[model samples]
Target: MNKKRGQQSVVFSIPPILKATAAIAGPMEGEGLLAGYYDQVMEDDLAGYDNWEKCESYMMEQAVTTAVKKSGHFMMDIDFLLAGDLLNQLIATNFAMRSLGRPYLGLYGACSTMAESLMIGAMLLDGGFGNKVVATVSSHHNTAERQYRYPTELGVQRPLVAQWTVTAAGAVVMENGTDGPKVTAATIGKIIDAGIKDPNTMGPAMAPAAVDTIWQHIQDIGREPAYYDMIYTGDLGKVGKELVIRLFREKGIDISRNYEDCGCMIYREDQDIHSGASGCASSAAVLCAYLYPQLAAGKLKKILFVGTGSLHSQTSYQQKESIPCIAHAIAVEV
Candidate 1:
């Protein structure tokens, strides 16, 4: 039986294994340091599509297909498709699912959808409801910019604190097997509001939520910071990553030794990505393309992946509502 931990976590007795993974990134990411890690790199954000949204859908389609193929399974072998994106109504995910012809579930966690899908998929597999599932997410710089901020056509000036939304997609195939890393625990975070309303400064807005979830996960699992070889957070960027370290110091726990943000890892300093990267793919691409390989190679033994999101819509922002943030944590072990 699964044991409930503390207030918001669970320890699984039958953890699900990650069978295969794939990641596809756009031109900007392709030029980054981890370019060699991705399976496919698009020369342009349009990806030969008429518009950016459709291009995002195409990226997701390719990611899922590649992941399934790498798993040595056909499309029919997948039991469920769990996915989402940054677009309103998840247009990218919906369109991709329509063509995949698989039983699917749509999710919206702003940028945290990747980890959310993985956790839900793990539950289904561990509970014997399914033997195989695919979790995927995508985001496009052009599509997200016009919807959340200014139109890309205008070439609006981005603030120094602003983060670039990544044009990428990533997918992971999970199954009941002993060939890979297993998800051993999960911590579901609660919504946290820190009275921040500036959409341009999302790192500050979402940092508190990430810290909250990280603290809870450690306490609930009764593990110290040294328990994991490393701890990775979704997209907190440089500023937000520092804030997490400071916040943890205030709580008498230090995580600086084994902590890194995918946002900081995705882009290079000369890439002009402002602070760093953000989006659903900020974490997904990094995990699938880089971290998974390290774990599979026995370079890393244990890790905690925390997906963070700022839950705010254009309407909510226009209404002067502060951003509400959330984070979910998954424990992965080789």
Candidate 2:
């Protein structure tokens, strides 16, 4: 794993851990920076036109473009696609893939889509379904608001810990006959509830789902945190991540030493950010952008990236109720 990122490899793992690998996520924020085209697209209230739709479409395109570039592979060369997005309709992901014209298995797991897609695509390739596959997931603050929580015109202040529906996209190209984690075993997650009341406090709402999936992974495989070089949970931010650590430790499992929550690792508070993370693309961008580069450099030998999302509905919010959270973890080896 990339501890003390940009400093040096803080931990060491056995060599030649895995060979099969690729990159596909992107970034949207930076110091005093806004990614430009996004601002233009998002500003458009044109044609009753929605920017979230545009951003989602763009995320897929960006991921496809990124995968092809990073792997030095082409779009047509891909055999299958596993893709998704957190939306009322899976339009963004599907439309993005439609442009690529590759046969695919469409999917949705909210923020966890990238990991879900990766698990399935890897299994497809490793199972000999195809020689190559591509996986991607995308979400947008603008579009998701319109569909799930609010309309663009509202502009209400989001909670301090609220996640920014990541403005970018993520993707990866998977190739067979390479030495990586063999897609050996997996446990599907079920929704979990904590009965949290605040609509703005997604952290508490999503904690149970994170715990549920983490618990299932350990129970099904009968493994401990030490079994993996790193255990990562997608976008749980500081609050949910803390809850997960406490809950897991009580179960005689300790993931804290080598564990990281993508939500917390990617941002700095002094950097004009609070509570550290937001967006479906948070984990995707990290995996494809940062982790892939490190893996190729022989830094990370094995990693388990878990993606988490709140599955609350609009009705639930209006009813002054709690939200359901869902999470999925995908273990990726060098």
**Top of the candidates by TM-score:** 1
**Model 2: per-residue Cα lDDT over 274-314, one tens digit each:** 66665677777667656666666658866777777777668
- lDDT per residue as tens, model 1, 261-326: 999998999998889999999999999999999998989999999999999999999999999999
The positional error of residue 151 in candidate 1, measured at the CA in angstroms, is: 0.8
Candidate 1 residue 307 C-alpha distance from true site, Å? 0.4
Pick out the ten consecutive residues of candidate 2 with the lowest summed lDDT: 3-12
Instruction: Report lDDT (Cα) of residue 226, candidate 2.
Output: 81
Question: Which of the numbered candidates is closest to the native, going by highest lDDT?
Answer: 1
The lDDT per prediction is 0.93, 0.66
